[model samples]
Target: MATPNTAATPTFMVFATLRDDTDFAEFAALREDEQKQLEVLRSQGRIGAHYVSPARRATFVEVVAADEAEVAETLATLPFARFFDAEVYPTTPPDPAEIAHRARA
Candidate 1:
């Protein structure tokens, strides 16, 4: 029998800097690859990922994990990990509902 995936208390944010020469079409393809990877991570308790684009020289990627180890493994597995300037940070994110709740408080 397999153990069910567990959720981590605090997630993580991973940042990736795209190569200077990266173009839109290329990153778009890369994004598809990333989505595939996320499916694997999701099975292992990954919360989600966030991606950002800058006018030039880098892209930022964020991955929310159940714990540090989960984040580390996910980062290592990313096809683009070695291609970009990458860093992982520990984080606690507010749920969207919580954010809405806070806005009203």
Candidate 2:
């Protein structure tokens, strides 16, 4: 089964990995700033979901936006933008059964 996509609401998936030259001190300093920014986005109903990778060093975020430019603008607000390499993918919901089958495989 194919999942439906709404033209009015576009979804984006962000995968962020720590850069080799990331400075821990600067990263720590920006944590509070990023958290505050995320809170504002959340309040605005922009963020769909967010999670840290199992390894604890990476982050994955799902956002709702009008277009790619909006997604890029939102991501640019993150304080750690310079410290991470990020990939942004346009996404849609997947079938639950297919996801379960993949898990079983």
TM-score of each: 0.56, 0.76
Which parts of model 2 have CA positions greater than 4 angstroms off?
A: 1-7, 54-56, 93-105
Error of 1 at 25 (Å): 10
Off by over 4 Å in 1: 1-8, 20-32, 93-105
lDDT of 2 at 37: 88
lDDT of each: 0.59, 0.73
lDDT of 1 by residue, 1-105 (tens): 112232324556666677666566766778778778767765554435455676655555555555667666667786666557767787666677644643443
Question: Model 2, 32-88: lDDT tens per residue?
Answer: 999998987766656658998748679998776777788777788778778878899
Q: How many backbone clashes does candidate 2 have?
A: 0
